[model samples]
Target: MRLRIVVLFFVLAVGFVLAPRAAAQSPIVVVSQSLDMRFPRSMRFNIETKSNTRITVLRLTVWQNGVAVGARYSPAFAPSQHVRAGYNWSFQSLSEGGYLPPGTRGEYTWHIEDDAGNVHDTPRAAYAVEDRLHTWQTLSNDVVRVSWYEGDAAFGAAIFARALSAREFLAKQLNIQDIRPLQIFVYASKQDFFTALPPFSAEWTGGRMFPEYGVIMINFAPENSDWGMRATSHELSHAILHSKIRGTLGDLSVPHWLDEGLAVYNETSDHAPDDQFERMFQLAVLRNTLIPLRKLEQRFPADSEQAQLSYGESYSVVKFMIEKYGAEKFAALLNIYEKGAAPDDGLRQVYGMNQDELENAWRDEIGARSREISTARLPTLAPRPTFEVSSPLASPTVLPTASPAPTAEPTRIAQAANPAPDTAVPAPAPALPASGLCGGVVMLSGLVALSALKRRGGRDSER
Candidate 1:
């Protein structure tokens, strides 16, 4: 009996030791921060905890718009705790995926929890966001100003030179002069570039451009001049193309297919006859899922698979237009849009063909199904080509756009555009992708194609 009593006592003692301890008394936390979103400037947080009670939770919540995103850390007290949490609107955003790019408004707050079951919330703080990148090192010309970190000054100049060459090419093709003061931001490292994006940005996105500010953000990995120059050229085409259309029409109302097509067309690749885009496009054609020009002109599929088809269709059709019809006639088509001519009217006037006629011609040349997609009959922003599906040549008021001469050494053609379904933008989506384009699945290995089409109907609306 005595042994049993002793055993019971021992068990009780062990249980007592194993039980969770009662909460410690709370500590008093007084926190402050000197947040400056500028380079050659400081960005961090300072917290002062003055209490015997232990801290359980300490975190900084970076608020963008009203949404919160941040990191938690181990708590420290007294002797003036310093947290090196800096704020740079040019780089960090916590609100929405891209709650705030530079030149936007946002707020942030801190939270603390103590062992005493006590919680603390800091007052909301505001940031005067600006284009802090402007303060970075710069290389400029009459048309563009290239911004870069000190380490990438020479690279910045190189891209600037390449951009000028691209500008000449785009202007000649679009038949428009460059007037905008373009600025390209060259991130020395992908990490730096990624850090500056909204949380929702996709991994595939390598660069972005905003026509509003004439801003372009591209990454340069030390010595990869080939990619840097190519990317620079690709983005420059967007700026030039949009500015030209807007200049001509007094509004940037160009269609996505046309806009993206023109951009991809300007891509100069070492592998001149790659067939990736062609195979993907052909697959779509064989599947009988080719998006009719009507559906493609207004908006593209939000699904990647469906979206790839649209990109492929756009690139293919545009390539066909340029090669089949003379570049001058194509320029005239753009001029029609500039004059506020409807797409159908523009086709009829320029090529003496309606939308249907053009669609049929493209389908036949590519050996795609001569039949029209049935889903295309569903509601779309604009009407499909007027030519009947039964006959591709139903309404040719003018001669066929195809060439009669033997094809000059046939080259392979292929590519598809982005199909981001979840990303949302706050600004009017640029009628297309900003060049937010970075997060898109532009899958072609070397083509600066499929820029993430942030269909944010606002701010960055698609073309």
Candidate 2:
């Protein structure tokens, strides 16, 4: 009987040892997470894991404004001696495969699978990635608003006027009367400006429009104030075009050429016929490289030089339509787009001509020959402010305000136009926690940076 008791005790001890592992399998502990906007294609995340585990699949999926932009996956490994696996990230080697555009916010989650086939998932947390160098100052009216840094209040006022004035003119020209909240972000420097953009954004791009969010990001250098406002007007034209179209039509997509040409035509200044555009335009004509107007409806050339020439061609073609056909016809063509009519059908209905005839007439009028045309799918290039169009309904946006004191996370301007209700994707079933693993988790952020400054009060006491 004593021997039997001993055997039973041994079995009980073994069961106790294995019971915890079988009954409760806690998720992987998140040590820290961050995204360096400088490299938008990569995600830097750290995790705590068991020593014996090998991470076979580590995936990250990002959802922007409720739209799943894309996902990136990687293989990662961790050491048992050190519980921390530092910086396991998915590098976006493909052009559009894992690219994340800047000046946007999204919810991202980590999905991890271990060598033993155990799976772990993190809750989708909201993240806004934009420039956070200085505290912002905002100036607003009913229809339009502007926000800048402390010393840029004057620039903000100037841009405010520019935004409203351009809005009035575009609305009158388009024969539309509707309002969408337009928020402008004015960064103080070029580096700060680039910091707010995706990697492939062009160097010459001074401003961009996010129609999905109804926001504009512009680099406002005090030294180049005049040119900065011009970019402001240029981007505002795009904002007006996109917002008015959405307000009028439910959610119709427009062509690139018409979209860009109208934005360019609204620019405050005009160049001579033989100016900057002529150089690239004439070269494309000499080489026979201009994309057909119908083909250009999709995108321009991937080559920057050829792309600029495409812009010139688009502007010239759009300008010809306006001059020869008149703004009334331009409005009518927009009406067709607003109605979601087919592009060629709209071309035939509005202008009584096909795209080929239109392209030939425009090229002939410009006294230039057409180029060797290729129909390859062009990667969406910079300065075009390419993005997936969101629903016309606006989601309740959060505009972040920062205090003089340090913040754990940079404040964001969550302001949205025609904001819609939030929609959250359901997460996977969570596993029960291991005994000690159920303890508190701390998020690593900028809250611990030490700050000390000497000061003298009015009473002459040093502080």
lDDT of 2 by residue, 349-428 (tens): 78986667678778787777744445664443222222323322211122123211222222222322221211223222
Assess candidate 1 and give its lDDT: 0.53
Q: Runs in model 1 with CA error above 4 Å?
A: 1-138, 150-158, 198-204, 220-228, 246-251, 269-275, 285-289, 372-463
Summarize candidate 1's per-residue lDDT along 358-434 as a digit string, tens digits.
88898899897675534454332342222111111112223323222221211111211211121222222111233
Lowest lDDT block of 10, candidate 1: 387-396
In candidate 2 the C-alpha lDDT for residue 404 amounts to 15
* Whole-model lDDT values for every prediction: 0.53, 0.53
Cα RMSD to the true fold for all candidates: 21.1, 17.1
